[model samples]
Target: MSTLQTSINGADSSVAVIIPSKPNPLTVTYKDLVTECSSFQHKLAAIGITNRSPVSIATVNSYEFIVSFLATSWQRGIAAPLNPAYKQDEFEFYIEDIKSAIVLVPKGAYDTDAPSVKAARKFNAAVAECYWDNVKKEVALDVKDLGQLKGHSKENILQAQPDDVALVLHTSGTTSRPKVVCHRSSQMSVIDVNVNELLC
Candidate 1:
């Protein structure tokens, strides 16, 4: 089972992702989160990121970041998360390296001086300003469909393969030029095994 399914099958009603903007805590169940993810998936389909092409998200800590990331994963897109603190040269190099199709930003966070935004524009990729609050309202997954999708949809859709590069963590070059280290999805198991042995 995918990580998403495991979370949903083991859901708690009181479980929630803390949204800092709201006065009161926004409570969302694992089931609800999955539904929201699916809805966002459909939204992406409507917007045209599918198995053929993928979208990339660029953000600092904002509710949009979580939603967009989940949505992209649900849509079987390659998610390239960039450091929100990257400088102009680093940002430009990373964007070019990943060949990102889109850059998702918060509703009003766009700055001409922002390195990621400028790099995104330079690459001729689309920039989407997502409103987390609005997305929560409009994009919600169907509760009944969740079980079915969880059981089969993930498998039927292309599961990111062992060789598929999940993310690129750019080295923070305090002394020299930044370079990237590609991380493949399958290597996670190896890391987990090694960590378990060390802990034990």
Candidate 2:
């Protein structure tokens, strides 16, 4: 299995997450998490994200960030997580570096003027939205516009190989520019599983 199946190992009755910071932890099951990932992965593929395509998540620490990263990896694309506190130059560098096909930010005007959104727009990346659906009581992902390359069949999602890049992180870059760290499927799956187990 790849990083996409992180929570599959711990599908038992465990506290999956909490809603916001209200100290109300949500009782999420493994089957439920996998279903969400499957649904979101189809959405990612529908928006033209193919194998090796980069999808940058510019948001705070929340369920949206977790789902987005997993969905991207599930689509056999690269998941590039970014710090929402980045300034203009930092955002520009990362957006350009990854050549992201899409950028998911919090729903509403939160990211309207964000440097990350601006930089992604320069490259014509589809800026999407992630929001908490009160009715469903779940974090949902939405996109205003799909890329031109969209509309491919979602019937067959490409599987990640051991050498395929699943996650891309950047170093603080003291010597020169930020250095990108690429993690393969094997490494990413392990990292995701370990981190998810601890956090969730």
**lDDT leader:** 2
Model 2: per-residue lDDT, tens digit, 1-200?
A: 44445425545544444444555654555566666667788777766788888888888777667667777777788988877778767777887898887877777733366676676666777778776666886667677545434564543565556677888989979888888899877776655443354233
For candidate 2, the 10 contiguous residues with the lowest summed lDDT are 191-200
Model 1, span 1-200: residue lDDT tens: 23322223324444545554556655556556656666676666654555424355667654456556656654556667766677767667777776766666554546444676677777766666656555446432222111111222222333334554544566778898767676544543243221112112
Q: After TM-score superposition, what is the CA distance of residue 125 in candidate 1 from its true location, in Å? A: 0.9
RMSD of 2: 3.0
> In angstroms, how far off is 93's CA in candidate 1?
1.4
* CA lDDT of every candidate: 0.53, 0.69
Candidate 2, superposed: residue stretches over 4 Å from native: 1-7, 10-13, 147-155, 192-200
List pairs with backbone clashes in candidate 2. Answer: none
